[model samples]
Target: MWISRLSRFLDSVKQTLFILGTGLVIFLALRNSIVWHMQEFWGASGDFWQRRWEELYLLFNQDDFLLSVFGTYIFTTAVFWLCNLFFILLDLTGKPEFLLKYKIQADKNTPLRPADFMKAAKVALYNQTVVGLPMSVMIFCVMKWRGCSCSPADMPTFPWSVVEVTIFTLVEEIGFYYTHRMFHHPRIYRFIHKKHHEWTAPIGLVAIYAHPVEHALSNLLPVALGPILLGSHLATAWMFWALALFSTTVAHCGYHLPLLPSPEAHDYHHLKFNQNFGVLGVLDRLHGTDAQFRASLAYQRHFLLMSSMPVTQQVPEPPKKKSVSE
Candidate 1:
């Protein structure tokens, strides 16, 4: 009975660990080769970066680095919106035959209405322009005042890049967990976080549909704080931000697509409203906030699904369906 109860849990852990290990190994192994090919093809060498970095330093004086700062934010954010659009379009299609099987809350939630999609998009746009842009400018100013490097030549090596990104993820996880939980406080929820939670079964566009204050503090700060504390190179910062955006979008995306991490955990958070606050589930597990989630069917359903089969978990084979002969 115990084994039966834990079978799905163990399988989830195994699948997650395997994916993490394989991704780490592949990224580490291919990193140097990828960098070499990039450098060779672009005719970029140590000298080239040195000059470029120097030029960037000089350019900073002329425009106060506004161009680089805004350009990076805009470019990375565009990727996030494009990802949102992809899933939004899919959801708006009313569970097309092909994707219907992948929908996690298919029975409970209705197809995304065009009106709701437009509302989410409008709020997201408002947050991006009104809250996001100013925050980016402020952060850039602070980084400059702190003497943080934004130069091309200051980029971390591939191995160190991996380490830094891992640290950023940890930092973001802690910040996001606490801030997100704080917003769920009963007193504060109605005023600030309520807008975001309106979509219990969230779609990708709902990822950024939040109060401007919540958007800046809860969403952006957790992510930007890591790079700021580390004073990372601009390129590394952008890379991490892009990954964060994509991952958040995927988390809010209702369907479990192939070759991507499962959206079950965060989707469960939206459905249940008090569980799985952190991005990686680190703090959730640590704080026991995931107790309800783990005990629910959603936890059992979590997996890196690779096929078109309905997402499910392994059970203990039902005691071999003992027959009369037994």
Candidate 2:
């Protein structure tokens, strides 16, 4: 389940890194319109993004309009791919020694298989294309509704506002925690939030696979909530979105890496529902939703200890049909 340091630079590594390198290039190249989308794409629809909702198509017709529009698409698509690449690499090179060094879960679940991966890939891509584009447009509209501009010249400069980023992430996490837990109500879980629970053992790609309503209510709105509430700069808003996406994906990544967000609790939620509902697990523990899960973790430790103890005597199993030679 591990690879040597020497194999790190082998052909497989070279090819994987090449693809990621190309993706990073595309991600950086489309930077301008990526920021512009939040500022200009639907800047004119400040009304509809709030109370109107019908004027969502409002546009500026400014110079280089076409380029900005195309760039927005390219930028967002690239962002999704880049995020996808990060965890996909973990799952893809699942046996790499580097990954084994950080894996937290003592027991390995089912081996990562191609069929299951393809299914997750299909769902993840569907959510990005379906939910991601519309969400970007909505972010612009809401910014406009709140009287914020998308013009980079007027926006915050290079190197985003970290202070604002932390504040925004905190606000989003709080909102997401409450709303996500609410969605688990027995009356609504079956119809509204059940799609996300389909995968008991989640991978990186499984993070984005949710019903559109869940994506909008729990995922998009909460993330955009902080920026809209604070009226933060466009650049700050974009950075917050990136962070939000990263945290969400990491939570679904089955492995529990030391420095990472500790996704095992979330992993447990997928396997055994009705637990670990909070984004940061704060609410889950405070309200005792994770009490059952924490107890189970302790139990797993005990089981491992019992299994590892030396046996004084061996018990033989019933013999199967004898071999032809025997």
Candidate 3:
């Protein structure tokens, strides 16, 4: 029995890894292809930045800009990973039973209609375009105001220090954590966040997908907060933006593999509507919100099993549709 169970566990691991690896490859291919075309189009522009190996090395040697960029990268990535780590642990180990209990039912009989897919796509595009462009511009303006040079060659020179990055990381974390939770509050959620929740089981495309107001509020806070609190340079800010987008996409992809947390961690919250609230950790544990989440999962599994029984034992279907003329 133990051997059989071990074999099943290994098979599950393999399947999960396969899904995650494929998703990542697809994401990278799409992202890089778009980035390449964008570069080709804008490369000649004086304001556009081209990422090249030589230039990257040169930029690193420039103490001030390099220090700032590296600091921001470490800070943001650390906070993002740490938060995901905490939640994954909670979901996977702290409550392994939660996984089996709260499995989301795939409504096979009522497959996701075309309309649902379109709505999700539309919301995703609208949210990204409306919020991303304006926020990018605002961040650019702020960087200019702060006298931070954007050009790779013109970057400032400063000593590399862990202390600086640590401080910046804390500021960004606090800003993101509070802003994220605030949007989920009932009052704000109705107006700003409800649209994103339309896809309870998100599939990566809907990662940044949100209502315009919510999108603006969510994206702008980190951009604005970094400059005001940490006085980060433009390069650092841009890196932060890229990392944030990548991480958000991963969180919504609904697959887990080595080196990353499971989408189950975040997807479960959306499925049940209340729990795992923190972007950086399991805040639900401290606040007792996870209780309902546990119960909801159990409720979902019971219904799912009942719904999956043979058609003979299932409820009768509605009468067949009559002809339009009839």
Candidate 4:
């Protein structure tokens, strides 16, 4: 039954792929043209950086600034939708069971109604704004005090030794792993992390979607904390953002990819309400949280083999109707 359903879905996906491929080609062409025009204009001036700054300020005249703000909203929403679509495709292709098991688990275990999902979305938005905006301001102040003119283009060239970035990433990962596990403790779960765990079998949107406190703690630790402690460059910070976003999305996707770890590795923890708290495999392995996961996998494999035997298999029947008198 699963195979038949998957085959039909794939047939539909073929059409989707062709349309998506055409749309992407057009989008890339338009984007590249706009970028080229902007670069040409900037390059014509002898003091290109200075002129570019002037252009930005001028372009952001009160009315334009408002329009730009709206534009940002549209751009962000579009990116999020695209990411969601990609994850849906990944779920269909890599783990058809993801969708199949979702209804079963949600009905059985999770208390996630539509209201809960809305609340989580609100929390995610509020927390990101509250934490990210202040951190950005603080970073700007520090950069100004240090006499640094770190702009977007200069981000790639901003001086931070590779060793420093590497050390910072490791430190941040350790902090994240421990803090995440700590939140799962029964004493703290309701206050800090329960909103997130409400979606036991999550889709991609739940990646950064959490209670305000949980969101601030989870997001700020890796991105803001590392930069502040290490005095890292804009480039390092940007790289961290990319890594964090991509990893979080993949983790929440609930599908295993060839190069990435299985979402089953994390999804089970959410379902069972404990264990497997590490972003990567290291901390979970060290703490023995993965032991049950290994055992469960072995049991499932054995069960599948046994169930596949013709002699052991039996067809389930519809229940008999009850009499009106009963």
**Can you give the lDDT of residue 129 in candidate 4?**
62
Ranking of all candidate structures by their lDDT, best first: 1, 2, 4, 3
RMSD to native, candidate 4: 14.1
Q: Write the per-residue lDDT of candidate 4 for residues 1-326, one digit (tens) a residue.
A: 77755654565456345433554566568976865774576456425544554454345452322322332234334445466666554443443443333221234323335565566456656655665455455555564455433333333331233345555556666777787887888898899788788777776668777766666676555555665565554435545655666667666765444445346566667767666676654555555566686566421321112222221123222367999998
**Candidate whose lDDT is highest:** 1
Q: How many residue pairs clash in each candidate?
A: 0, 1, 4, 0
Model 4 worst lDDT run, 10 consecutive residues: 303-312
TM-score of each: 0.80, 0.64, 0.52, 0.56
Query: Better model by lDDT, 1 or 2?
Result: 1
Error of 3 at 270 (Å): 0.6
Candidate 2 whole-model C-alpha lDDT, 0 to 1: 0.61
Tens digits of per-residue lDDT for model 1 on 1-326?
66644664565456446544676777668988976785575555545655765675576663546644666667666988888877876787764567766777777445777789889889988988888888888888877766666665465665576678878887898799999999999999999999998988888888899999899999989988888888777666777888998999999988887778889999999998999998887567656688899987788777777766667423211345678998
Model 3, residue 204: C-alpha shift (Å)? 0.7
Candidate 3 residues 133-175, lDDT tens each?
5555565556656776545664323222223333444455556
Candidate of highest TM-score: 1
Report clash pairs, candidate 4. none
